[model samples]
Structures are given as structure tokens and as C-alpha cells.
Target: MTTTTTARPRHDAPAQRARRGSTARRETWGSAALLLLPAVALLLVLRIIPTFAALSEAVPLGSERSPWSNFAYIFSDPSFWNAVRVTLIFSIIVNPLQIALALALAVLLTKRIPAVGLWRTLILLPIAVPQAVSAIIWLVLLRPDGPLNGIATSLGLPTVPWLTDPTWALASIIIVCSWVGVGYWMTFLVTGIKEIPLSLYEASALDGAGSWRQFWSITLPGLRRPLLFVLVADTVSNFLVFAPVRILTRGGPQGGTDLLMYNISERAYTLGDTQAASAATLVLVLIVVAVVTVQFRLLPGRED
Candidate 1:
């Protein structure tokens, strides 16, 4: 008797709810657009504009006789071809070397070891240092009379030329690059390894699987995506290597370390050939695109 009649359900409740949802969606879309605007604007200003500008500079607009003069100049130059060869060799060596070392370090550090955090921090310290600064530090260390040579001398080993001989110069550059890259790539693999469930490892252990067996079966499969990312990024960065080449080698020791980027810079700044530089820049971009495309096709992903 005391219970009042329940209020009649609002007839327009669903309609009101639909209107609220629509408003919320509109707000969400507006917020997303606002957040994306800055990034879009910067991309246009920095990347797109510069690419088009380089294109414009590369082509000889005034001459119908040779529209491809800049490209022809680049192709005919021995320096350009040398740069291309060096770049390819560098990619072939550095990409696999860095990834392999990184994988090894990642597996080692992920184990329950003493001072693991300290070890990781020390490895990653190179990344925190700017590339130019890192290059300078390496420059000192690699000098003929520097600490590295001194150590070799103390061990009664001949002090080999680190940056003064052609082959040794290229190797020195590779060493510097790997030193910087290994830790950075290792961090990514570590993150990938940690994502794997602990139960899987325990199950493998219970099944009498050794550490090597578990790594091959579980760790490698789990790391496919991360490995792909590291490979592509490492390839691109190695192709674009200029700082160390500039500060340390200067594409010297008989042009053995003349990477395409340093070659392009020499053309642009040192030699005052912007047209050839632009053409070389476009070539570099095309090479990167082609290599990355091949990587995407060849490498298996998580979905695969």
C-alpha cells in the first residue's frame, strides 16, 4: 500500500541517449583533429616541403636539352659510385652485426644477474650522448696515440692505424656505429622479451628444454616484430651515417668511408654543387625506400 507507483520510464530516453552519443563522438573527433594538427603541419613544413624543394633544385628547369643533367652528373662521377658501394657494404655488415649483438646482450641482461640495471645503464649511456659528441669521444679514443692504441701497445701488440688506413678507417667507423647502436637496439629487444609470458618459459623448463632450446622455440618467435623493426631502423640509420664519417674519417683514408650522406654533404657544402647534391639526395631516398620495401617483404611479422 505504501509503495508509490513507479515513475513511468521516459519515452524519449533512447533518443536522448543517441543525441548524447553523437555529441560525444563529435567532441572526440574534434579533439583528435586538434591534437594531430601540429604534427601534420610540421611534417608538411619539414619533410614534404624540403623533398619538393630538393626535387626542384635537382632538375634543370631552364634546359630542355638535358632535363636529367644533375642525375647524369651524379651517375658519371666516380665519387658517387664509391659512396654507393661503401653504403651497400656498410648496410650489409652493420645491420646484421648490430642486431646480432643486440639480441645477445638482450638475452644476457634479461637474466637475473647482479647489477643488471647498472649494466643496462652503462650500455645505453652512448645513446644519451649526442652523436656529434659521441663521435668526438671516439675520435679521441681511436687516435694513433690515444688510449686504445696505448692499451694495445701496453699488451705488446702493434698499434694498428684505426682511422689512417682505408680498410681500418672503414672498420673503425663500423666499430663506432655498432658501439652506439647495439645498446639502443638491445633495449627494444629487451622490451620484446619481457612481453613474453613467464609461464611459457616455465613450461619449457619443466618439459626438459634447455636455455638454448627455449630461446630458439620461444624467444625468437616472440621477437619477430621487434627484430623486423630493428632491422629496418638500423638499415636506415646506417645509410644516413654522416656525423662520425664527418668528424672522424671525413670520408677519407682514400674515400673508403664515403657514405652517401657524407658524399651528399661534401657535394653541397664543401664543393658547392647543390644540383648534384639534390640529385644525390633523391638517389639516397630511393635506395632507402627500396631497401625498406625489400625488408618488409622478406621479414615475417606478428600477424604472419
Candidate 2:
């Protein structure tokens, strides 16, 4: 009698639920696509299209020399090699210097310090000024007769040739790049640091961990993703450095500051060798991709 009283199942319930879920998923995907359309379109137009155009221009066509001639020419040129060397050296020095300074400032500013906002504003102020304007300003500052040398003279210190001597010219470019980049990188680190839970620090203190120990264990691990991002972005930015080199050095006191981008621009604009410039562009892109790939592999926390 009890078994006989058992009602038949509502067979359509599960199907109805499935239909509802499918509809919801479709709506969610549609919304996401709508949200992403503008950015995707912009990237396609600005970046993807131009990169393909450059690639087409890079390859030699009918009635031209060998398909690899442009690349061969650049590879054979001493100036191109010098630009590569200078770019590598600049990257080796500037990336670490900027990240270290930015991390230090991030840590210091995130502490309970008075007038921290004012300090941050002052640091970030340089980013608001255009890089070209910044180059012009530093052009004046680094000149032999400018205020920097005037101060050095007042202090009885040797007046340095910041932008004229080859070694000093590269160093001056590094300085300018770092001054602009450090604050920008610091903002990212500061945001990362704030996202770290206060409970972790408190727990570490309770466990008798010193400031340095806490930083090593907690802060650095928290910063892995942010640091990786900064590393890649900073590397790319440094590689594409052209304005400062063009404005300040014009590829050098002995080609010392001729970064790859400046070299490419010089080939295209100055010498009217668009083919060589396009080939160099491909090389620059490849180098950036390789460097960034290595950075991603080395840094932990990809899951984040």
C-alpha cells in the first residue's frame, strides 16, 4: 500500500533546470563578449594590423633583392650591433635599478608615515610630464653649463659630462628612464602590498619574526605577480625607448645610447630605409617576446 502511494517523478523538472542554466550561461557569455568588444577591436586596429603591416613590409617582394636581404643588411651592420649592445646594457642596468627602488619606496610609503600622500604625489609628478618634455628638461639639467653643473661647481665637485661622454650619456639615459618609471612601478607594488592581509603581519610578529624576515616570507611572496608584471612591462618600455635618445643623444657620443627603437626610427626616418626598419621592428618584437617569456617562466605564482 505504501509503495503504491508513491507518486510519479516530475520528469520535466530536471530538463527545465538544465534549460534555465543553459540560458543563463549564454547570457553571461554574451555580456562578457559585449564588454570585451571595444578593447578587442582597438587592439586589432592599432596593434595587430600594424604589426602585420610591418611584417609584410619587412619581407622582400618581387623585383627586390633576396627575401632576407633587409635582415642580412642589419645583421651585417656594425651600427645595428652597437644598438643591440647598448639596448642590452641599458636593460641589464635599468630594470633592476627601477624595480628595487620602486619596491623600497612602496614598502616605505605603505608604513605609518606622516605626509605619505605628498611624497607619493611628488614622486608620481614626473609621470604626468610628457617624456619629450622630460627629456628637454633633463637636456638642460645635464648640460655642462646648466644648474646641475652649477651646483657641482658650487660644491667644488667635478662637473660631469652627463650627455656628451659615451659612458655618461648612456648612464644619463638610464637615469631619465628610471626617474620616470620607478614611481609608476611603485604604485603597482603599493597596491599589491595593501592587498596583503594585516593578519599575516600580526601573526608573523607574534611568532617573533623581524621586519626583514616578515618581508622575505610574506611580502615577497605576495609581490610575485606584481613584480613579474613590472619586469615584463619595464623591459618592453626600455626596449622601445626612442624619444629620449632622439632628443638627447641622437644615437650618441659614439653610438652609446642608440637603443633598438632609436636605431629602427633612424633607419626609417633619417635614412629612408623602411625595409630595414621593418625588419628591425620584427627583431625588436621577437626580443621582447623572448625576454617576457623568460621572465614569466622564472617568476612563480602563475596561478594567480
Among these predictions, the greatest lDDT belongs to: 1
RMSD of each: 6.3, 6.2
Q: After superposition, how far is residue 132 of candidate 1 from its true place, in Å?
A: 1.6
For candidate 2, the 10 contiguous residues with the lowest summed lDDT are 1-10
lDDT of 2: 0.90
- Tens-digit lDDT track for model 2 on 124-183? 788899999999999999999999999999999999999889999999999998888899
- Window of ten residues with lowest summed lDDT in model 1: 1-10
Instruction: For residues 7-64, write the lDDT of model 1, one tens digit per residue.
Output: 5456758887687668767777887888899999999999999899889899878877
Per-prediction tally of clashes:
0, 0
**Candidate 2 positional error at 224, Å:** 1.5
Candidate 1 TM-score over all chains jointly: 0.86
